[model samples]
Target: MTIAEHRTDTTHPLDPMTTAEVDAVREVLTRDGLLGEHVRFAYLGLREPGKRAVETFTGRADLDRRFLAILLDLGTGASRSVIVSTTRNTIDSTVDIDPATEGQPPIIDTEFELIEDILNADERWTAALAKRGLDPATVRAVPLSAGHYDEPGESGKRIVRSLGFQQFHEKDLPWAHPVDGLVAYVDLTGRRVTRIIDHHEYPVPQEQGNFDDPAFTGPARTTLKPIEISQPEGPSFTVEGSVVRWENWRLRLGFNEREGLTLHQLSFHDRPLLYRASIAEMVVPYADPSPVRFWQNYFDCGEYMFARYANSLELGCDCLGEIHYLDATVADDLGQPRTIRNAICMHEEDYGVLWKHTDLFSGTRETRRQRRLVISFFTTIGNYDYGFYWYLYLDGTIQLETKATGVTFTSAYPGADGAGFDYATEVAPGLGAPLHQHLFCARLDMTVDGDRNAVDEVEPERVPVGPGNPHGNAFRSRRIRLTSESVAGRLADNRAGRTWHILNPDKHNRFGQPVSYVLSPEGQPPLLADESSSIHARATFATKHLWVTRYAEEERYPAGDLVNQNPGGAGLPAWIAADRDIDGEDIVLWHSFGLTHVPRPEDWPVMPVDRAGFTLRPFGFFDRNPTLDVPSGGNGGHCAD
Candidate 1:
């Protein structure tokens, strides 16, 4: 299949901006005199239509086409949020943003190159590199987010902390060698180095970290036979533009600069399950408390905009078996549309069994095989490659699985045995991989049956020996309705098998219970950072496993809109202060889940894939088994295998 290009026709309100639409956005901004040398496009994406607009959409030609363009004034350390209407060729509104108070906007791709240029041009930075017995040309200095620390001179500036690693040669991985104890804070607005802090020097690791090449492994293994997956009649799903339908499942896919992929109007059997869903934000906070690496927490989705770096997937590599690919269009720093071919992969997989039963009395048996429609995309941010996958099963189960794989971020070890460092593990001979947590927050805007929904925190509790439970082995699940936003934030208890249900207050199943879908969490610990730490406040959303709030259009991002260098208490922590009523009203659910990584020796060179996610299962949404109608059969050729 050939890759798709710009779309001239807009079919749905939730459809992503086409390449032509992106060009029109730039034209409107340029006509309004918003384009200039000092001004740079930090982020550009389709401004999501309001809930009513989407619900009322009927493929109307008069649908509003709006684009959100975040522009940064590099000269003044300020930004502007411009909403451009492509239909009218005009700017609908513009909001002036002051970095001093409103926090810095996301850094553009050009700024990464500028950071390297600024560091190489600086005399002090080169001298520090020379003092470490390293040449400037053999080192690759990169920019990292300068987290909010309330330090002396970093209060109101657009700053990026710089760290360099020894390159040695062109093919050598820079992460294998660390030029420790040296840091430079660069003010991008001023286009200069603000300060260079160099503590005691440490020797850079000398081991090579390349393991993918043929020269590194010597010979390839030939013992494994080829395992091919083929569907003779092609995939089971159908796609019309961004909308996908398979079995009884249907949803529209969305992609943008921030959130890589989003699903809208998720339904099973034409019953609304989730109105919108996406991985809203994620933070990777290092546990090292060293002076040079203390403020090392990174908001990969919010701060760095990792979605902009999405990998162009290929068949038989990222996906297999009658795959369908959807290309995504995003804006560059110059406000030009850039197309990522095969950005989204869609296919189906056969799970073992959906339902099975055997009647020994009658000597009869019945079984049904299971299948799921998979929609996924991968993005590589720096040294980490992450794949976000959404699965829709035949039995009304939805799951989001995150795959993390790539080279581990390394540091220099102090001792030969790699002791005394409490927060890091030696992944290589002298390379220390710091302990870090990849905390991800997913936003679920649900419409169980209609909009009048409520959330109930359910926990299975143990029963005591009494008149009701004299056997001393009885237990029952308890449900608590979360009425308001203040008490909606909750932590997961694995011991109690805690789960949450989003149900429609007006609808019920055949059993007279509220029609609902339950969210099953992995129950991983929330942010491990202390309350007194700066990251604790900035990443307050990750402090709780679940948060429920009344749905508001502006309340989309969990970590606030601007997450570059902003202080704490802006996104989830700031919004719940309203304490709005959430029960029996339109509400949104935010679930945080992730992995805490302490690297091992086998994780060096290139780390294997690690998975983390949550699932949603129908609780009382249906009266009987939904997949009872699924076809029961097996591949005829499987007997020979």
Candidate 2:
């Protein structure tokens, strides 16, 4: 019967066995040993289940009268076996005939019935497999490997041949030695080479100086080695014939006498002249020599200035109470028949103070009034030189921002770990902390020109001004609150000691006025005796006067806290404080200026050439000393371990 018909016939139920049934199976299978041979049964229906049954029986089967005829297949011995099926029925059988003498006979009715009975016990079969530590569902079929055949039609023949012989064809061998001296072997399936074995005797090339064997004993050509230069230890040039030329361009007096005329190499300290002039012209309607006052007044003040002179040899102005100007003069010195075609202006309040009278020709009301000054100077002693200075004066105290362009040092903020820890928690428990110290420090030297007889030690005090005051009811005055202890004291006490002089403005120049003062010889003192107070409070004070407490917390006209509550407003402009959100993720601290106090002549072509810069610093405004232990890059080895 065909495999399909056999599967159908074997599925039928059979009657209980009788003596005749047993004898009929015995007579057909006892006479000839049908067991002890590896056999396969193919099914047309339920192929997988049938195959599983065949695998479990380990024998061949065929359909019989009312049951399946099965052969006992131990291959090597005459043995008894059982078959079970999915229905929990079991069939047991024994082949009594000897295969040594009589050839194997066809399976009989009795054997078929017995096999069918066993296979019907599906549960028993499952239990038997489970007992034997096998999971029927998880069982996999392992394919047998046969040698390759030259023709597709010869595959069966090749398998037959491969089964009879122990060795295979060279191409079908499953293992090979590569022509490139590598050994390759196929897996058991004989499909492809699974692995390659390398047996070369020499080692592969490797990068030199791996981590395990780090050696720095080469010629040192790859690294940069410092070069030492020792010039004859003496003055390089004699000062002979060196006429001190006051270079007007660079606001400095150069010693070189190359050009007969004295030249001033204008440095940052000299920039105030330009800044003041520009600001003045910007404020006063008749301030500029050009007859554009009526036109300028129509447009936004700063825009008008920029449109008129941003690029031209004129001055530009801003809203800040300051002035800036540019002038080209044939006259040699500052005070001469100079065509000082410059501009001047001021903020409304400052303008009122400088020019109180309504009359245009009236001289300034107060010559000694505080003024915000910005200056730029350019000169050429030998090469191009420029300088600029920004001055803010209030209540007889002045703070100068000086910059010497081109002659400045560049620096970077310290890495994360250097700044000190946040102390906000220590102070206010939950509120944020103030920065322990400033990330940058600048040094400046200034010369003041005022009433030589004016008392330098005026002991400035907070005075009131308003409607009832003598100055008229335009502005109100508030008491100035200068903290008894300043950042100067704290910096002096820090380990950096005298080197921290940059933060102590008092040590650099006394209140923007020429005075004798130095950093306290002793180190800084403790900022606060008690840590419970707000660290911010300990660092910054609320004030009104520009010289004392000009910083505000909010944009509310007169009285408010400082923006971000940062000490010293963290150098941010009061107007910027109004905006809650800015595009950049971090707050930036910017400071720029010119350096040197000298002015020269070469800077005249573009007189008052100045350098201006800004810095973007991390504003962990609420963080502790951000640069506490940061080592200064060069010459800072003194603190290194």
Q: lDDT per prediction?
A: 0.88, 0.21
Candidate 1 positional error at 272, Å: 0.3
- Candidate 2 lDDT by residue in tens digits, 194-286: 333332211111112111222522343567665432223321212112111111112311110011111121122232111011111011011
For model 1, the run of ten residues with the poorest summed lDDT: 632-641
**Candidate that scores best on TM-score:** 1
The TM-score values for the models, in the order shown, are: 0.97, 0.16
Flag regions of model 2 displaced more than 4 Å.
1-313, 317-340, 343-385, 404-641
Whole-model lDDT, candidate 1? 0.88
Best by lDDT: 1
User: Using alpha carbons, what is the TM-score of model 2?
Assistant: 0.16
